[model samples]
Target: MTGKIVWAAWHPRHGFEIPHFYDGAVAFADIDDAVRLVRTLNADDKTNNRNGWRAVKTILVRAP
Candidate 1:
């Protein structure tokens, strides 16, 4: 099955929010793969310290 992944970023203290999309949503063959990618991106963002923006959550949606 195919799915779409959605992610967002937010600050810890300020409560500022940033919505992110990956070139019209990312398509994955398996939901597990999509979750793995989310974890990887989150980890990378923390490691890289991308302007204090870190991946806060991921949503998985089955393609229609």
Candidate 2:
């Protein structure tokens, strides 16, 4: 753990029960790991598919 309580990331709208793939239901412990996951997820996704089959779709959201 980073030992610093911080922000959390989850897909409630997408129906994610708990945080998957990342360390926990929290922001990445390290910047590198977060970046890696982003790249991997993008690679796994197909064009125009977004969160399609075989793609682990996790989104980064900003307050609206």
Candidate 3:
């Protein structure tokens, strides 16, 4: 199974990391991976990060 990334944080406090949250969704293979990515991203001091997002949804993909 392919894992996906997700970001639910929509507050301005999220800062530049907001886009990363959304980008990760649908890119991870499982929750664990997604959580890991979230943790890593959240660790950044420049932006607020979280383990999940309220707008959790699959990202758009296109065929080659």
State each candidate's clash count. 0, 0, 14
State how far residue 11 of model 3 sits from its true place (Å): 8.5
Q: Which has the higher lDDT value, candidate number 1 or candidate number 3?
A: 1
Which stretches of model 1 miss by more than 4 angstroms? 1-24, 47-64
lDDT of 1 at 59: 54
Model 2 alpha-carbon drift over 4 Å, by segment: 1-26, 47-64
Tens-digit lDDT string for candidate 3 (15-39): 3245644542234445566555555
* lDDT scores of the candidates, listed in order: 0.47, 0.39, 0.43
For model 3 the TM-score comes to 0.38
Per-residue lDDT, model 2, residue 9, is 27
Q: Model 2 over residues 1-64: C-alpha lDDT tens digits?
A: 1245322322324332233454434355455564454455445543222342122334345545
* TM-score: model 2 vs. ground truth: 0.34
- Scored against the true structure, residue 33 in model 3 reaches a CA lDDT of 65
Question: lDDT at 39 for candidate 3?
Answer: 57
Model 1 lDDT at residue 63: 52
Least well predicted 10-residue stretch by lDDT in candidate 1: 13-22
User: Which candidate number has the best lDDT?
Assistant: 1
